[model samples]
Target: MDTHSRSFAKALSWRATGTIDTMIISLVITGSIKLAAAIGATEVVTKSLLYYLHERAWLKIPYGRKTAS
Candidate 1:
């Protein structure tokens, strides 16, 4: 079953991958380590929260969730 802790862990793991991706793209565009770091750091927080909220919202909808047998 999905739980808050599971959702939180998923958010953190996904944010790690996403932050690195943003950092790489930001570095490519800005050519500045400082700027890339700043952008990545900001997104890490923002997107993680966004994702957690989204997950909780989806959990309530019961659209595609499967029941345990």
Candidate 2:
């Protein structure tokens, strides 16, 4: 493992059990639940884009080398 990977893993860990992640999850869940109501519109497009962006943004974080600590 390298520094970049470590940092990325750290970022994911942070996102997994925090306020930011909770909000993201909630948003996605709600959007999916409401998809039927919004058929074909900006809402679906925006939700799709947001999900992609969120994944890509997290991918940018660097995972680092392992440490004794």
Best by lDDT: 1
Give the per-residue lDDT of model 2 (tens digit) for 1-69: 235556556544553344344455555777663553343344444554555556566566656635578
Off by over 4 Å in 1: none
| Candidate 1: tens digits of C-alpha lDDT, residues 6-45 | 9999999999999999999999999999999999999999
CA lDDT, candidate 1, residue 57:
89
TM-score, every prediction:
0.92, 0.32
Q: What is the lDDT of residue 9 in candidate 2?
A: 61
Q: After aligning candidate 1 to the native by TM-score, how far in Å is the CA of 8 from where it should be?
A: 0.4
- The clash numbers for all candidates, in the given order, read 0, 14
